[model samples]
Target: MRLPCIGILTISDRASQGHYEDKGGPAVETSLRAILAMPFEALRRCVPDERPVIEAALSSLCDNDGCCLVVTTGGTGPAPRDVTPEATEAVCDRMLPGFGELMRMESLKQVPTAILSRQTAGLRGRSLIVNLPGKPSAIDLCLKAVFPAIPYCLDLIGAARLETDPAICPAFRPGK
Candidate 1:
């Protein structure tokens, strides 16, 4: 089987400038390592919360790097610098709002402030791009909620095939 390519992007001004360490990107990588049993490679990047930069990074990952799935952390809040969703939309051909909605709903069960999260997912070519919260805890919660559908979505987009260990995180497919 071919190994899938996953892109991890951290959008934080402080983290990008080396003023602080990036916990979100590592959190995402850890989560994927725990759940994804299929062979995969990660392409990681850290950039400031700039729309153009985010868009360019996403474009490069999808168009040039040939990543099947790109998960971005940070810049999904209501803050002024939060432009990850906008950049995702600008690069994607279609938007998958249910992923964000489910993430927010799941997060709301843990914290009421989840309503303020603007997390979203979109499709750029064959790649499925998802915007996640910066906080490591929130990232864990959000990823657990939406990840079940990610492999199937990637399959539908002709990206790559992924199989999960049912004992760990069973992926749901209609006929399975």
Candidate 2:
């Protein structure tokens, strides 16, 4: 059987330029390590906040690399350059707004500025793409809030089956 594969794309001009570290990507990786019960690989990419570039990377990860899931960090704010969600929407076949709703709702508990976040999730073919906040702390919180449903979402979309560590995050599979 093939091990499940996912992509982690970090969107940040400074990080892409090497002026800053890509903590958000690693934070996602760490959460995956803690939450997943099976083996998987995370293909990482760092790029500036360019819509075309983000779309291309997301496409390449899902279509070319055959990644069943792609999680993006950053570029979800209201700034003019924050376009990850738009890029995601453009490339996805269907949009799942509940992911963003739950993320913002969970994030709002930590900081009021979570309202400014526009992170969203969508399905591109068989791959699932999710936009997340850039902050490392917020990434963990958002993942915790939304990941319980990811495996089932993947199942519904015909993506790879991802089992979660019940001790860390028990995936909800109805009638399982």
Candidate 3:
């Protein structure tokens, strides 16, 4: 069977320009590796915090590359350049607001500034696009907080089936 294709997108001005090493992309891969029980291919990309660039990358991943899920890190902040959410919203046909809401609610337990996060998730074609904060720690936290619903969401969207390790993050699926 062909492995499910998943995209790891890192949006950062410095990382995309090679000025700073990209930790968020790898961080997302690592976290997913630990949480996912099924085999999959992780396609990684780094782009500057430009809306057009981010949107194009997202389109390529979902429309061209056929990524079942695209999880992005960075550009979800209050900064003017933080446009991941906007780009995702533009590319996605339907927006899933509960993801950002749950992530923020969970993150608020750790830091008061969690309210500043603008993380979100949406669906583009059959692919699920999720936006996450830039910090590696926050990436892990937000992913864990929201990933429980990811598999079922994929099932609903007709993407590739994704299962999670019960020891890491047990996925929720009704009557499964």
- Residue lDDT tens for model 1, 1-176: 45788999999999999999999999999988878887689999999999999999999999999999999999999999899999999999999999999999999999999999999999999999999999999998888888889888988889988777666667877787
Q: On residues 1-176, what C-alpha lDDT tens digit does candidate 3 reach at each position?
A: 88999999999999999999999999999999999998899999999999999999999999999999999999998999999999999999999999999999989999999999999899999999999888999989999999999999999989999989999999999997
lDDT of 2: 0.95
What candidate 3 gets wrong by more than 4 Å, as runs, is none
Ranking by lDDT: 3, 2, 1
- Mark the regions of model 2 whose C-alpha exceeds 4 Å error after superposition: none
What TM-score should be assigned to candidate 1? Answer: 0.97
Q: lDDT per model, in order?
A: 0.92, 0.95, 0.96
Best-fitting candidate, scored by lDDT: 3
Residue 28 lDDT in candidate 3? 98
Expressed as tens digits, the lDDT of each residue in 59-110 for candidate 2 is 9999999999999999999999999999999999999999999999999998
TM-score of 2: 0.98
Better of 1 and 2 by lDDT: 2
Give candidate 2's error at residue 119 in angstroms: 0.4
